[model samples]
Target: MRQMHGAWPKDALPHRIWDESYMELQHATRQHEFVTSLYVQAKLNTRALLDQVIPAYEGVFSDLYSATSLQVLRAVCKDKWMRRRL
Candidate 1:
């Protein structure tokens, strides 16, 4: 034990290094959770806008819009198959 202690510098305790790493991991986890929450909120808002608001203009601009684009958006947003592709 004395030899081991002598091998490392005074400021370089293994326990202290482990504690600092643990603290850094905890901080990273909190940051990941915060970013994930923001992503969920943005996804929910986009879903709401796509599902509820865009349909209101469907009839008015039915002839002006491309059928293929509308179909692809509906598939990716509302259908399960395209969502799996995402």
Candidate 2:
């Protein structure tokens, strides 16, 4: 057991260090969550944009352009085996 000293400083160095570390960890966690949320939102927006854009140009473009666009789109949006090759 430790004896209490009334004259000791209430905001000791160790306690201040621990509080600072805890605040930093909490701030980092919040930042990570914010970034992850943004990434998910961007992904969803990309998928939606691809859905709207792909069909509009599919048959109107030249064969090479059409094929490459489709291949790239599939690689980003699907889990097919071709995605592994990309």
Question: lDDT of candidate 1?
Answer: 0.68
Q: What residue pairs are clashing in model 1? A: none
- TM per prediction: 0.43, 0.46
**Candidate 2 residue-wise lDDT, 28-68, digit = tens:** 99999999999989867765675585655445545423667
Local lDDT at 57 for model 1? 45
Evaluate all candidate structures by whole-model CA lDDT and list the values in order. 0.68, 0.66
lDDT of 1 by residue, 26-85 (tens): 999999999999998986775567658566544544532379756766765677766687
* 42 Cα displacement, candidate 1 (Å): 0.3
Error of 1 at 52 (Å): 2.7
Each candidate's root-mean-square deviation in Å? 11.5, 11.0
C-alpha positional error of residue 22 in candidate 1 after TM-score superposition, expressed in Å: 0.3
Worst 10 residues of 1 by lDDT: 56-65
